[model samples]
Target chain A: AQTVTQSQPEMSVQEAETVTLSCTYDTSESDYYLFWYKQPPSRQMILVIRQEAYKQQNATENRFSVNFQKAAKSFSLKISDSQLGDAAMYFCAYRRRTSYDKVIFGPGTSLSVIP
Target chain B: DAGVTQSPTHLIKTRGQQVTLRCSPKSGHDTVSWYQQALGQGPQFIFQYYEEEERQRGNFPDRFSGHQFPNYSSELNVNALLLGDSALYLCASSFWTGQGIYEQYFGPGTRLTVT
Candidate 1:
């Protein structure tokens, strides 16, 4: 069985600053996918970024990027130039490369962007 | 284009009652997945439907069943609901590329309260 762990329960960063959220997963599969999703108070889940296990290079999407260390099984999300809109519940998720695989999510970390 | 859409933004039901939640996949998306997110917790995978059949399921009881229509719309049916079933149910849609690398677009979840 695979499991995702998000160590931080809560995090805060000043606007225009940077913050990093930690995530680790336990999986036996060699090839898989890791993701970060943000859910606002409106309760909509939005994809922030994703990383492929085989890709040595980390994934980056504008202000959101991931530090995927395959050997350590650690995938972290770094938000640069944080804004008020970044205050939300962020979840780390895992999925297998199979087309029909189900996604597993971590407990989540609540982020607060201080203005 | 519109993203995923769920019906009945909120629902309240009594214990032991049954409830059904509907989801319409985004345009051109053929796969639909259902997740249950408890308060302050991340979403848990319930199941995934593709080609009008359930292809994958998580550690959920049989009471949680689902169906995918020909048009790619899906429905999650929970029978004999318990208080533990009260949570925000999210529906995500994605296209299954042959390579098995595609991002899921989530819908504004349906909040189900079992009292």
Candidate 2:
């Protein structure tokens, strides 16, 4: 069984500033994927970014990027130039690279973008 | 054009009662997955359905059953529900992964309240 852990229960960052959310997972499987999801107060869940275990390079999506440290089993999400819309509950998830595989999510970190 | 969708945005049921939740996969998606998200916690995987069959399941008990229709729609059924069953039930969909990790799209989720 794979378990994801997000140590930061809550985080705050000023608008236009950069923030990094910590995420760590324990998985025996060598081939898997990691993901970041955002859920606003409206409860709409959205994908932010993803990374494959085999890839040593990180994944970047516009303002969102990840620092994937495979050796430490750490996949942290860095939000550069954070916006107000970035204030939400960020969840770290793990998924197998197999067909119809299930995903496990972390407890989540509530990010507050202050103006 | 539609993303993943779940029916009965909110539902209230009594303990020991049964409940059914529906889901509609996103356009061009063929795999559907169910999850349970508690009040401040991350979503827990329930099961994944593809081609009208349950391809994977979580550690949930037999009380949690599901069905997928020929149209790619799915339903989650819980028998003899308990108070702990109250949570936001989320439905997500992704393109069938013959070989790659496709990002999943989620719905707003169906909030189930067991009183």
Candidate 3:
């Protein structure tokens, strides 16, 4: 069983600043996938970024990136140049590499971008 | 690409009643996964449909069942719903390369309210 944890329930950042959302997971499997998903007021779950465990290089998507520490079993999301549009509930998820279909999600972190 | 789309953006059902949700996968996507998001929590995986078969499922009860059509569209049925079933039902789709990448695109979700 894989369990994902998000310590921060709420986070706030000033406009144009950077913010990092923490995420940790307990997984017995060595190969898996980590992801960051954003849900806005509309409650639409949107993929922000994804990191493959087998890849040493981190994943970056525009202003969103992930710091994946395999040994620590941590995958944190860093949102640079934060905008109001970035304000949302962010969730960390996990899926095994061998069976990528079954996914597990962490409690979300509510991010507020303050002007 | 229409992305993943779900019907009936909102629904209201009574306890012990039954409910059905629909989903249309993204263009060029062959996999559809369903999730349940409780208020103030992350979305929990329900099931995943690929090749018109249920490839994986979460810890949900047998009351939850689903079907995937040849068009790749899907339906989720829950019998004898409970108030605990009240949540936003999200549908996500992804292209299956048969590898570890499960970078899914999510829909706006159907908000199911069980009274």
DockQ of each: 0.87, 0.89, 0.75
Question: Regarding DockQ, does 1 or 3 come out ahead?
Answer: 1
Give the DockQ-based CAPRI class for model 1. high
> Per-residue error at B32 for model 2, in Å?
0.9
DockQ of 2: 0.89
The lDDT values for all models are 0.95, 0.93, 0.90
In model 1, the clashing pairs are none
**DockQ winner:** 2
**Which parts of model 1 are misplaced by more than 4 Å?**
none
Task: After the best TM-score superposition of candidate 2, give how far the Cα of residue A17 lies from its true spot, in angstroms.
Answer: 0.9
Put the candidates in DockQ order, highest first: 2, 1, 3
The candidate 2 chain A region of ten consecutive residues with least summed lDDT is A95-104
Expressed as tens digits, the lDDT of each residue in A1-115 for candidate 2 is 7999999999999999999999999998998989999999999999999899998889999999999998899999999999999999999999877766888999999999999
What TM-score does model 1 achieve against the real structure?
A: 0.97
lDDT by residue (tens digit), candidate 1, B8-114: 89999999999999999999999999999999999999999999999989889999999999999999999999999999999999987766688799999999999
Residues A1-115 of candidate 1 have per-residue lDDT tens digits of: 9999999999999999999999999999998999999999999999999899999999999999999999999999999999999999999999998776888999999999999
- Model 2, runs deviating above 4 Å: B97-99
Chain A TM-scores in order: 0.99, 0.98, 0.97
Question: In model 3, which runs have C-alpha deviations exceeding 4 angstroms?
Answer: B98-100
